[model samples]
Target: MTDTDNVSRRRFLQATGGAASAVALAGCTGGDDSDTETTTTDSGGDSKERNLKITWRPLDTLDPVASTDSASGWVIQQVNDTLANYKNGAVEIESRLATDWSIEDNTKYTFTLAKDAKFHNGKKVTAQDVVYSFERLAASDSSRRASFILNDLGVKHETKTVTKDGEEVEEYKPNSLAVNAEDEHTVSIELSEPFHASLPMLAYTSFSVIPEGIIGDVGDYEGEMSQKKFAKQPVGAGPFKFDQWQQDTKAVVKRFDDYHGKVPEVAGVHWQLISDDTARYTYQMNKNADMFNIPTSKFDPNKVSVEKTDDMGRKHGTYGPVRNGDTVNFGRVGGISNHYVGFNCEKVDKKVRQAFAYALNQETVSNNIFKGRSKPAQHFTPPAIFPGGASGYDEHAKKYPYDSSKAQLQKAKELMKEAGYGKDKKLDITLTTYDANVYIEISKLLRDKLASAYMNISVEPVKFPTLVNRGRNGKLEVYTLGWLMDYPAPDNFLKLLYPPKTDTSKKGMASYVNWSGTEAAKKATEAWDKIQANTKPTEEAQKARNEAYLTMEEANWEDAVMIPLDHPYEDRMSYDWIDVPMFGGAGRSRQMLNTAKFTGKRN
Candidate 1:
């Protein structure tokens, strides 16, 4: 999920940030003293020693519980293994740490852990570890996604409202979450209600099993280390182990020999922090980085050639014979996310919001800014999971049009005039966004366009963390951000626009856009309520849910709570010698490098 800056797996993917080391080359040695050199035989029967160097943005946190952005998720996933994972390029769940699972009565889920799975410290994974992990995640004050497990999935937990520094806060009761260890290798979870997306939700990295009693205060077990130390150097049962993390520079992870899954083809992975798009492109072009995302400024659609598109819409191809005269492998897929400009509805008038939405051309912005790599989003939910699916998306999009044209401009001018802003009275506001080149460019374009509609917009680009903090505190009036899917479900996207989730009084995450006190909010909430009550498997129930989604979409559009921008395409370029796996659009944050191999000699 991206808020403008960090692309957290389900939290945020900063349009710019990632977690990587500052290594100059893939083969260079730079990590903790525990790092060792190893050689692996390639498919061609040739043995070579190499470290996978990848380009990434700055990471926010590595603590899985507290991680809400993709930059941190990218690294946390490497060091932690979840019970299940999405099949490559699909929403289908596949086994990871848990070999098999069973769901009974829709509310009871039992997972059998793989007996062979071992933590980085060589501790065998047990049912107790899984229980401890879930409990810790549920109770941690630092966890940004506690609600996902506690409420979304309906995990049975007890909470008490307490006053902290004169402010009310909800605290979880000890040993109340209905997660239990049935046996040494089996774990059982009881939910407060049946949820269809429970399995997929459990696949989230926040539920990753760590060594039992590794960190204290959240669980009954006495911990071996402080939570602070664990965040810096976490140990888990994933394919890779945390080796070193240099703040703002890079994070290195060495392959774990005791990993139960297929061992990594490379000795380790060197995540190089190249936040600058141009610098990252240069790093890959210079052969310093093996795999990287092609910057929009550097992307040439003419140079891209698609070989095939999978069932899930993942395009596999080659990039180009660029300035280096080499054609690199390419992959592209539509992200299950949307980027938009949100308004603090409490502060910004509805007419003003509608005027701004009318004045901005989503298609033009997406085409010009993203080089035609993204599709203009008419609704918050991407077409892949929009209501009744693709057809439902088309119907709603046509019913509510927000694209800019001569007519739209006229409407915007009229609305601005009605809102008491005209030639003499101008609506001046600052548009806050992450300090990324792409957002800066987008903000500038918006500023220029809105100026004609009697609105003077100032662009304020702050760090990704600051932008998120200000947004949560309702300190931002107008801001640009994006939401990547937490799961492959419509509710994940729709919930963002749900007024209650953005109520500052409720300490909402997206509270910058305070739309809770409006008629539109009530309508959207009603639709959301209908959706929750209609989760049965019957055809009628499904139809009602889809209709409710349409209602929510309509409510959001009519009120102009947020100006939906575009659905971005996830694209990547890798050196021809590397066999980089294509993850398609979903679960990019859970992308694992263990399967990546050096197929040939690197140039």
Candidate 2:
């Protein structure tokens, strides 16, 4: 439902560094003495002048059209305003840029722009801006999410043949997309078919409205700036404005006074790029960061005391009294994502893939590696978005359950032997993964477990970006990656395994397993086609769609396309004085500090 660059879809956990090394480096105590030098007040005598500080990993591009990862999306959410957005802590969509919208015939959508909405540039938002934004999103070569508009949403568009160099090639007709500025403040969009998830899909950052004629790439009118400049210093109608970005160091955004919504109480937000687990932990313990994540290496279950759990499965608690003697508020929610070991189906035989899947135990990984902080994932789709929701996940999970039992190990050995591999003729393959300590540890476990199954597994640790590039180029025989939800829908997760997305020629970022040429692929393709056909909101249609999801998942199980490891829990540690949004199924990337309030002094 959401469009992201292939790399964006692959989310990296915040925790880095080995557990032993991290604990040894920082101890179970506080930060350095020098880190305690805190500024209590600003020139205006407000203690909140230092603003809210958060630790994050390195970000990719900031351009909404080009950004695919959650790192960039988090900052983008601050500087951009989409037509609709997920309500905080919930998947329900709410109006943002548009005051309200109406749907007709389940295909056509009409939105009435907020009369008071104004861009950071002080220009009034209009229907033309919305039209231009959607058009650019579809036509711009830089847009990784163009498919979300053209294909996934089934937006009506026309193509025309134009001669380039010596041959003729087809491209979208200028302004031919089925979006129209009906008036100064009304915009209408027509879809090729009725899509049940259209509203939620529109909530993605890719549909964020920017001033029309700002860039020269999509339309003939170009006035403001180049695409590159806009990416670095974007102007939007959100509550925050782009301040500065220093590559791998940090990015800052200042509050916009003229924001249409309730403005942020703080002066700005400072996102510190701290990739080291110890450093992030120390920074938070020192009270330098108002809100941050507690690395698994530094997390102690005994220190956590849960007060209650919400209906949405969010746990509210307090964690603390560390060596620094600080007790911070804590929150935990099941993440809408799945981390897995993917096989290149074109290079690895199906039986070998199945053998590896059976050999690796998800429960062991969840317990030993994640320390019970995550749930074992049996299906590619996380339970929150699985067909029929979390209630039915266990039923479908029974279709293909892989455990580390002796019997399963025996089954794995048999599969490997049937694939013409044995102790003497072991099938050698390398699993490339992000150079994070957790992933490396998981890979090593997998290597050790598969050894008995006559599979010689080598673990290759690379930077996150490098891992993504290798997977995209089909240079990896096997790899470790994870998919975060772009939207809360079964189709969003299922579409990743859709057969056509496996076509390297089309530059598919998902389905690195490339099972497009196998019999399982044929069955999956049939189910995928059916899923597309049953997009209507009728009860029968929804039932048929759920059945298709199961069929496709069964096909994946039969082929062992990928091994679903575990669904991690998103945990947050923040000073009790700082009230942060408990973003549950809505996703952490959409966490907005604008609504956050400073309730009391940090003791």
Candidate 3:
């Protein structure tokens, strides 16, 4: 679910009832057969300079932390700048607000801010603001709820001093405050534990630094999620400044001339909430929309006349040949996401789950159903982190490779028999899914495959939020959904599913499927403790972390706690003549469009 920014495309689509808004789904934008005339700022006849028309499916919220969908993260990208930047599909790290940074023993990271960065409010950005931004993410202050960064840091600050090898060193505290400003320009972030994930984790959207003055107000966070004024009217130190946001309608932003980094060439950006996919695609096909999630039909070359090519020269069908239909442009990057089917572990028997996992045919779905638009997932983490290689550390012993052979089904049937569902007894299960063309089809696939195992699966299609809510309430036997990665890391994928611990006090599985009570869950929890205890913030630490995560994943495959579906390939397309630098990968930070330039229209 690269919508993951894509999943967001569908979240608000059903609600919009109009043109395609931002891909409110995890990142997959849907198209309606409805057609609507559209227009871009570009005038014809060689006068190519114009405003960028960025269309999306819909946006339910403007609040960054409260933004449950990736489309909102897309909005945050245009307005806010995080600590650093990701380029070439998150393979390289470039300087953004921070000019230089260093890490000590993987527990501490010091970032030096670029002097020229200024907020649209004309406030000078300082280390104090950065520290405040990070702290706010984990703060329990009632103004709002932050989803991404809190997964990394706890709600409260804890710290302690200890002696180590004849020297005093700070140890992980229960409620340790992790980030602080050493001086005006130097921001020091100290984790309680040797959390090697601080770098990539900081790259998430919710980690975007805002002016301290904005959030420093006494009542800044004391309001309902949507009513938080600061969240709606965001101020940031990025190339684009928020102009206007009409919820579910459109969002507008203009260039921030005082931006410290590379500036955007387009005078402003206009994101229209087009709910219908076909209309959205037709408009982009006619060059009305400058950038959008290219519809699945657009990927079909015969359906549209796309003649441009990315520098790599891959056809636009799946890899992206930027300009097609009326000669548009595109930015191509493999999606940094993992789509999965979450099982309610507390209710599901391990053998039942294992049998279900073995029966899934993700390869056929990714290739045949998604038509090469997605990669068959081998593990929970996205293979995109390594850029076109295997997505896991290594194939583990419990790997349930995609095998549709009768022998595999026979084994599954044998497992079912142990559960007493084989023979005349049919295991009846209700599967919940979001109402999207692809999701509906996926549910059907699951139903079809499980039939051979004598499992009666019923598919119930509902809205994305409702499906998520049901997962929280433990209402469904199996739920079809995708969790987008905030950043590229195994922790981002593992921690949410099998948390080190589960707090029943927090409602709805704490945004995870509540896999803590099972044996597979216990093993995964144990693996996390090992990763935190032994791993450092280095290549060796990554190796250790990978090994640990692979074990945990293998265990899950064996237990069938959760079933991984696929990692949908993500793409950002525009007219080739647009000359805009582009990014759409794992980290939401990559969607920042500051450095992009609009070079006239197509040739």
Tell me, by TM-score, which candidate is best: 1
Taking all chains together, each candidate's TM-score versus the true structure is 0.90, 0.89, 0.78
lDDT of 3 by residue, 1-603 (tens): 232122121232243222111111122321321222222344452322345666775665554555556767777877888887554324244567888876554455678899888998898999988866765665534213343444354323544787756767543342245577899999877655565445556666677888774654322443222326766787888788888777656777777778888776666667776655566666566555656666664465333333454443223432233344243443444566767777766667777777777777777768766766777766776654421235232333224554522225677787888888865889888888866557778788878877888889899987665675566565767877776766555666676655533332243234445566666677777887767665455567777776677767766775666677788766566655554554545533356665556555433
TM-score of 3: 0.78
Q: lDDT of all the models against the reference? A: 0.76, 0.76, 0.61
Residue 449's C-alpha lDDT in candidate 2? 80
Error of 2 at 302 (Å): 2.7
Residue-level lDDT tens digits of model 2 in 1-603: 222211110120111113212211111012321221233343433534546678887777788887777888888998999987866735656668877766677777888888999999999999999989998888887787887888778899998998766767666676889999999989989999887678778888888899999888887876588888888888888988888887767788888888888788776777887667787777777777778877777778788889998666688898888658988888887877888888888899888888878777888788777877788888888877676566688777876756533227788899888999887999889989876667888999878888899988889998666776677777789888887777767788888788778654344355566667778889899998998898886679989998999988888888888778888888888876777678856567876668875666554
lDDT of 1 by residue, 105-133 (tens): 66677888898999999899999999888
Error of 2 at 274 (Å): 1.8
After TM-score superposition, the amount by which residue 515's alpha carbon in candidate 2 deviates from its true location, in angstroms, is: 1.9
Residue-pair clashes, model 3:
70
Query: Candidates 1 and 3: which is better by TM-score?
Result: 1
Measure candidate 1: CA RMSD.
Answer: 8.0
Decreasing lDDT order of the candidates: 2, 1, 3
Model 3 alpha-carbon miss at residue 133, Å: 1.6
